[model samples]
Target chain A: MENVIKIRGLTKNYGKNRGVIDVNLDVAKGDVFGFLGPNGAGKSTTIRSMLGFLRFDEGSISILGMDSVRDHEKILRDVGYMPSEAWFYDTMRVSEVIKYAADVRGLDCAQEAAKLCERLKVDTHKKIKELSLGNRKKVSIVCAMQHRPKLFIFDEPTSGLDPLMQRNFFNLIDEYVRDGATCVLSTHVLSEVNRYCRHAAIMRDGRLMMLEDTNIDEDAFLKYYMDEEEM
Target chain B: MRAVFVREIRLNMKQLIIWSLTVGILGLVCILMYDSMQGDMKSMADMFSQMGAFSDAFGMSTLSIATVEGFFATEVGTVHGLGGAMFAAILAIGIISKEEDGHTGEFLLSLPISRRRVVAAKGGCVLVCLAAFSCVCALFYALGFVMLGEDIPFSKLAVFMAMQLLMNIEISAICFFISGVSPKINIGAGLGVALICYVYDLVGRVVPDMKDYLFMGPYSYANASEIFSGADIAVAGVAVGLVITVVAYVSTFVCFDRRDLAS
Candidate 1:
């Protein structure tokens, strides 16, 4: 498989505060890569930097062989991103927000968006402010995936989703991954990575601690976190 | 960019409508009050003369407050000056900062668009709304003057309204520039700019030495006395306002393009 994402020596700092440091990562086409980390482990920082939201002080990032920062718009043309904390214009209706996203990206997403809304049990008529957290998350999911881009970057995407919806969401992503789309799922949920990902990278204190094939290092994976917990 | 512009206009439509109504209603009220105040012109002018400090602070120091244009300038124009400045500030600041404050910056910045385009789209929307607001106020103002049989020339009214819009843009651009650079925002910058202009205007009028430096303040540039006099509109003031507006917008584009947006 071709490498879809490549990062080397990535570092970002927040006024002496740790953001992310010397982070390195690669995700191949058709790979369901799990980026696992504890809370405050700089998982979001890394993801944000990769998406060119936060500028990195050191290193380079390329998506589909294009520079992430210099060619962000081109990269985003085929990238679907879902933030860990979903947010939207409060006054906009669910349908309007999704439509606006689609329009901005120049995608004809009405059919896909409507279908996703139906599957997620989202009410399109409700203003975003009127929706619950879970419903808002659904809206975010629909907005991110409606365009059916080639790559998906999801940051703790299942946080507010109910179990059944979570399963559905995972299954939707799985379907895409099986169809040759690449995905990077950032989550702290160990079982999720164990079940869905072939390979995973573990992060701690803004550093990558391990990258291993889930099946081959399943025992070691369990041991590493357990030992870290004891420390 | 079009999508962002459309979305901004839609989101801010209610606020724009309210502001429009406020400006229009104020214009009508000023015109209506002219009838009662016109008869006591000499006494009213004498009373304003005595309260020199008060008149200067609120921009009532210029022409006689008895003429239709003078009354409108002193009474209605004061409200428009302050109200428009505040409105512009709020609009500009809210354009960029609202996303970050509301926690939507990550989602917005993650889109398949450049940050520069996003800022440009916001700027365009603000300008559109500002233009619409100025036109609405001018329409109502002209209507009031005509209804009361006042003989104000259309060209003069047009120039006055244009100056008001230009002054509002200058304030909005300054606040917008502030928003582009700041990571976090509250109403402080917007309110601060408006309050500062008010104070600066007052000081410029009361102190003879500051008169030379009055152009630094937008209120002085949009002075009602200058507009109603044969001068029609202050060409130098408009030139200065344009310079400030252009510089502010350029700064905004440069800063927003490079600033690290906080989520």
Candidate 2:
């Protein structure tokens, strides 16, 4: 399998505190890679560094065979990102916000975005401030997926979503991946990772604890968290 | 860049309107009151002259209260000089910090555009809005002169307004640099810059030894009284202000590109 994302010795430090340290990761082309971690395990920090949203103190990240920092515009052009928290301009209607995102991506995405909104049961006419948390997440999903990017990077993409919507979201990801796209989903839910992702990487204390296939022994995977609790 | 610019302009339009109305309506009111105070110019001037520190702080020392231009230089100047700088500070500081404050940095910074482009687009929006606010003030000044039948020179007023706008840009750039590097410190940066400018202006006028440091404050660069008195533009002040504006913006762009954005 060809690697779509290659991160080596990626280190980010916040003053005396550690953000992510000596982290190395890779996601193969057309592979659904799962990044699993508990709260404060540096999952979001690592994901953000990959997108060039935050600069790292050491090491490198290449997305689609291009340096993420040097070629950020090029990489992001074909990448979809859904942050852990969904936020938008409060005064903007959902439709306007989607349109704005579409414009930024240089896409004629109205038709696609509208279709996503319809499928996700999102209200496009309401001001963003009026949307519920779930609705906001749905809006973010539409923004991220409207262009049908070649790679999807989702940080806790289903946190505020209902179970049904979560299933629907996974189905959407499945549809895209079947068309040769790749996905990296970060979540703490091991079952979700097992059910949807082919490979999983677990992180703890700003470090990678494990990287293996999801078909591994269930007891061994449970022991990793069990060991974490003991520590 | 175009998308960011358009979004910024749309988001800040309400604030622009509010600030412009505050200054514009206040200018009109002050001009209307000038007529009532015309007959008591001697008494008013004497009263202002007696309050040494107060008169100097408000630029009422050399300006007579009877003349429309003099009254504007002293009264409207204090308001716009301080108020305009404050508005600009809030605008620039909020440009970057608002993303973090609203927890939208992840969404915004993740866009395909570079951080440098983000600064350019957002900063351009702020500059435009500030310019528009200054234009509104100038419009009100022209309206006041017409309504009061005052024969103020348009050329001098234009020079003063230009100076005022430059001062605002300088102040905003300073705050932008602060917020760009460390968005969490936005409140401190905004208030700190404002307080420093106010103190420098006060000290320059009240203390004999601190007069040399007059350029430290934007107040001096935008001195409406001197401009109204037909004094030639202060090339030194303009040069210094422009330099500061340029340096601050360059720093903001570079820092934002390298800085770690908060999640």
Candidate 3:
């Protein structure tokens, strides 16, 4: 398998407080890679650094064979991102936001977005501020997924989604990985990992505790977490 | 960057419209009032003396208001002072912080552009809107001259415009820097700050002692009736503008790079 992301000795600080500390990881192409962590476990910090939204004091990050900082914009074009909290302009309708997103990525997602929204049970015509949290999540998901990107980086993407929708999302993600797309998903939903991810990394308190390749049910995964945290 | 610039301009339509209409109508009304009061003063000093107490309160006697040039002085210092300050502050604060406040900044960062490019594109949008808005005010100025027949010097009109542009650009640059650092809701507070400075400008013009302190106001350069009296470009004004724009751009770049993506 080809390497899609390679990080070495990455460290980041926020005004003397630690953000990410000497982190290193790799995800192969065609991966459904789960980044497992509770809140404030450096999941977001590591992701931001990967996107070139944060500065690191020491390390090298390469994505798709390009230097992360030097080729940030070009690399971003090849990836789709679903932020932990996707926000919208209050004045813009769901359709407008999705359309603008597609345009920004140099794609025309209008027709695709309409179909996607319908599948996700989202209304495209309403203002963003009027939508429920779950609907807004669907909007962000549709926008992020419409580009058919080489890599999909998501941070807690399933938070506002209902259980059924999450299961549907897992099916869609499985299809992408089967088709050779790469994924880096961070979420507290261990079941999502059990459903789709081939590999996973567990992080805690700004440290990577382990990276695992396992087949386990949610019941077993929690038991595993308990044993590992005790270590 | 170009696409970003285009998008910013498209979204800025309502702001441009409101500022243009609001400033244009007020300018026309002022011109009509100027027509009614034209040559009513016996002398330049007499004009100063008649409003001596009121002028003393606001600082209007540094140069003469009796001549057409003096009329330009009054217009640039007063109209542009109040209106331009609010316009610059409101637009600048809205451009950057509005995205963050609404949680759109994170989504915007996901696009294929550097944060520097994003800031630059929005800054360019500011200049573009400023240019178009200036032209609208100029059109109203021409109409004012054509309809009112006040015989204000054509040269003085250009000087009035140049001075207004300088003030607007300077204040807008300051507001942009603040937008990068402050929370989105703080924009209204920034506009309030601009208004307070407007009062300072009104004071600086009538009081020469206040001239030294006029640096406190964004439009204080309009107080240059002493130097701009003969159409001097005021290199000091240019230098000040360069300083403000440069500092704002640098601070904005640094802030955007380090701040967490809110959306």
Q: Against the true structure, candidate 1 has what lDDT?
A: 0.83
Q: Which digits, one per residue and each the tens of the lDDT, describe model 1 over residues B1-263?
A: 89999889988888898998897888788888898778898787768857766676554566678778778777777777777888888888878888888899888887888998998999999999999888888878888898889886677667677777888999999999888888667578798998898788788778777877777777766766567654545566668878999999999888887777776
Every candidate's DockQ is: 0.84, 0.82, 0.57
TM-score of candidate 1 to 2 decimals: 0.95
- TM-score, chain A, per candidate? 0.93, 0.94, 0.91
For all candidates in order, the CA lDDT equals: 0.83, 0.85, 0.75
Q: Rank the candidates by DockQ, best first.
A: 1, 2, 3
Better of 1 and 2 by lDDT: 2
Off by over 4 Å in 2: A209-211, A216-219, A227-231, B46-57
TM-score of each: 0.95, 0.95, 0.87
Model 3's CAPRI class? Answer: medium
Which runs in model 1 stand beyond 4 Å of their true positions?
A215-229, B46-62, B232-236
| DockQ-derived CAPRI band for the predicted complex in model 2 | high
Which pairs of residues collide in model 3?
B59-B205, B59-B206, B59-B207, B60-B206
Candidate 1 chain A, run of 10 with poorest lDDT: A216-225
